[model samples]
Target: MLIRNPDISMSKANTVPFGIWPRLRRETCLDSGSSLGYASLVRNDCEKQRQIPVQLSKLSEKTTLLALVLGATLICGLPLLLLFKTGLTGNGGLDLGPLMEAVQSRSVRSALWHSVESSFLSALAATALGTLLALLIGLTDIRAKGLLVFLILLPMMIPPHVTAIAWIQALGPGSPVLRWLGLAPELGSTHPLYSREGLVLLLTLQHSPLVFLLVRAALRSFPRELSDAARVSGSGSLLMLRRITLPLLAPSLLAGFALAFVAALGNFGINALIGIPARYTTLPVLVWRRLASFGPDVLPNVAVISVILAVVALAAILLQGVLQRHLRTSLIGLPQDPLAIALGGKRPLVEATLWLFVAFVLLLPTASLLATSLVRTYGLPLSAETLTLENFTEVLWRQSVTLRAFANSTLVAGVAALVIAVISLFLAYFLAHRKPAHRTWASLALTQSEVAFAVPGLVMSIAFILAFIRPLPLLNISLYGTLWIILIAYVSVFLAVGLKPVAAAFLQMDGSLEDAARVAGAGFYRRMTRIFTPLAAPAAASGAILVFLTAYNEVTVSALLWSTGNETIGTTIFNYEDGGYTTLAAAMSVVVVAATILIMLTMNALARRVPAGTIPWKD
Candidate 1:
């Protein structure tokens, strides 16, 4: 009744029999060159089975894909294009005056320089640190690899502003955690993390997880033949690593660097909270100050500076993509596990050091945040008497803005997640199963999504402001300062995050299932609902969860878009700290961190349902 294929498990075969494939009287055979060689599904012997005509039952995939592309362009393209037009041109010709003045201004120049210097240095640090972690956890026999990876990725999930806040409390003069450790800096002395060095340190900590993810993905996807050949030629571990593996990892390293650089360059929370006190400024903070101080009157001038920031960010990402394309080497295998060499006696020491680093990076700061949250006041030392839960209670129950922010964040993020999930499901299907002529359209949509995500959230917000500050043409309704703008920006900016896993899941699927359903006279919607949805449901669910977690905690996307009653949790906490309500900020941040962890754990429970590597933290 069945043709056995060693490459594909019986469970997978069971998934493909959605229709009457088994009813065919023909013999089954396997194709060796099939994707992943899922031989059981490659039954070319069923040629007669596929000859059935179902023309009228076929769906309009082209029209659907075209509509998706147009929608993607509206979401991702028009805003930035409008922002550029507003900045680079006026009612007449080229508006070189404002652009030139922005560049020539002393403060603007200094901010630009600071941004470049800090991002470069931090990216360098992140690359090194993340590479080491990836190599250790990915390729070596480090103990508790699952634990290590989770810890490594944990910091990335925590927002940059929260990291800044935690570290400030961790290292500050009045820090309860530092005081408890007897390592507190003396009161009245300038806080150490309030300088350029401090900004770089915090940024490196914040963005290193991104590098870790990219580098580890590269390591996992690398071909093993290189390592095997080196070993057969009598190369030791270090020699092979230096000469073979590291050289092959150059593309990943450069990619990690670029991502880290762009993340740090566009960072707002650290630049604001730390840079302001130290008299240092960066582009994002400068944009915020100018816009916040002058409001819509200075929107055009701010647009000029935003254009410069956006250009730099885009250039770095584009350069990396070009270089990675040139440098990338295809693996002989579609997917395989990386080698896990034994560490011998050094395992204990490596494990200890790794855990120590995790403690400093994640645990220490989290502990500091908790301590800060428990305090009755900002500078008060923690004690049995001074300890209080009033801050949490106040934010969770008493404060109207806090309550409203919670509601708004939940509403917007949930709606965005749902919307993105549906769009990604269809887009992924088209991208993975399209005709040859339609490949470009699918890639075009993906590219636009990538371009939107590559730029800083700060810049995206400015673009949205320029694009939507005025009322809609026909509707005569303004989206500016509304929750809808934040939702739209979230959908546009985070489409990439939601699309990746769904696309990956689609790529792994056998197109033959859809073909069989069609041959059975099943319509497009029927095949999709009955066949593809069940298989990809787990991945789509995970993608939606990721989008929700990302958008829910974001401050930058809504930084400019949020208004009186439309505050998000991130903005609320930021405002609290900015307005000298540190205890409430810390309390709210703790709650956010807890909520993020809970959501992440929920996603982890879906790990088995999705493909490997879909859940980033899960091994």
Candidate 2:
């Protein structure tokens, strides 16, 4: 329950700008603490004599939250209904025969099994690496920690296929790294990168940051007191970690693992580039090959697979929600304790090992991309002699599909990001005012968002085709192969990704200001625009950046949804990779990475503008 300080006055003297509110949470437990604090603040009127009942405030919040939930449900549910209606009307409504036969196919089963196996291995590996990296960077006193953190997260900016290409180039025969290691020609045609193991390695390196970021965030609230208590009980650091820290961090680990797993499962670019050539057929590759090879014959099977994958992903997300709920219930009541486990004799060695591990896992792939971008050689043994700006220059001058793809990606992704930001801000605002009604609504919204994450890119694209193709004939709108379809796909894919951060930010905010605004006769829009939006700038900006980056770097959905005329960075890179244009792909990847970094920097700046402690809206 939120504590309300009745003694405090809501007057001109106390009314500050939007930034001062969040700081107050750090100071006053009376007015800013607990769910009850919010209702009290809302009820605290100089003109009113009596206190507001807790049940009434909760009921009001619940009602408001339900309305928001209903709105989101309509937005998400209608499109899906339309999609299915179109799919059924065009063909035979629901055809199971083809799908069933496809599922029974040996090749289909192999592909499914391989996809699951690769995704699981890669996700687990990424989780381990990400957790260790987060601990090293966030918990330990590492040198150049900030720079190292940036380096570690750099691979995430590069698309999986691009990373695969860069690695293949670097580690392949006569590549710079291979030559440096004195294992040039003897490496033969056997590349470690063009196999299932290679795909797993690439995915793990590329996706580990998802784990690292979430884990790092979780680590922030970890009190050292638990460790102190454990030590006082005569437990060593290792034992204390085993008994205490791990348990506390379990929810975070689960959240990260779930996300990484979904990412791996849905990944298409990495599988296309690395897994396909080695005859290692994953579900995504199989889906793409089927559609490209067999057309709509594999439609139902694709749908079944897509739906199944989405269900699995939804289950993971649901599990995360359950785990997070458990964590909050179990851990939120615990007091903050910042006690540290002393490293004793092995601190330096442990630190060094962690640093080296991070460097190798995070730095190497990015460095390879950057290194290859500056070079003209596609074969290997890249040297200063082979280094040039030709690749970058070509991107500027070439009137190829790559350039169009870049433009398309930027235009579509930019719009989607902006739209997502606005929607998430409102959703988060509503979520902030919610009580127990929050979980169901948030869960539903999250489930819709998880849809795109579960299905392979090709399968989702196929869904788009089956869903949209017949609609145009009926409506005479001709939406198929248009940018709208692509945009829609992006929104469906990224909505959840954008929502998570914004929801997290909202949860941190004190709800009293919103209540006060309501009491002051402010309508919902006025309260949201006037009070909440300004304060939530930081989180909104972060969400927008994440959405923008994901959209910009997206390969899977774009590859499937994009028509010949409609190109995206992913499609461009995929084409280049397909044609064995390795250096060009590296150059394109470099461009994407640069763009992501610029956007992130912009987000950071936006976050700093309404600095906390300066504005009342910070509440």
The estimated TM-scores of all candidates read: 0.88, 0.80
Best by TM-score: 1
Q: Global CA lDDT of candidate 2, please?
A: 0.69
Residue-level lDDT tens digits of model 1 in 1-619: 4444466555566333424445422323222344443444546545544443244334366677888899998889999888888889987978788899889999999999999999999999999999999999888988788777877887888877888899998899989988987889999999999999999999998889899988888888877888888889999889989997888898989989998998888888888899999998999999998998876558888888899999999999989989989987666755568888889999999989999999989888898899989989887788998999999999999999999998999999999999998889888888887576566788889998988888888999999998888999999999998899999999999999899989899998997898788756687678778998888877787788779888888887788889999999889989999999999999999999998888778767887877765575665
lDDT of 2 at 211: 94
Query: Stretches of candidate 1 above 4 Å error?
Result: 1-59, 606-614
**Model 1 error, position 109 (Å):** 1.3
Residue-level lDDT tens digits of model 2 in 1-114? 244344455542444444655445433333444443334444435123222334454556566666656645544554455434433433655655554665688887788788
Question: In terms of TM-score, how similar is model 2 to the real structure?
Answer: 0.80
For candidate 2, the 10 contiguous residues with the lowest summed lDDT are: 610-619
Worst 10 residues of 1 by lDDT: 23-32
What's the distance in Å from true for residue 266, model 2? 0.6
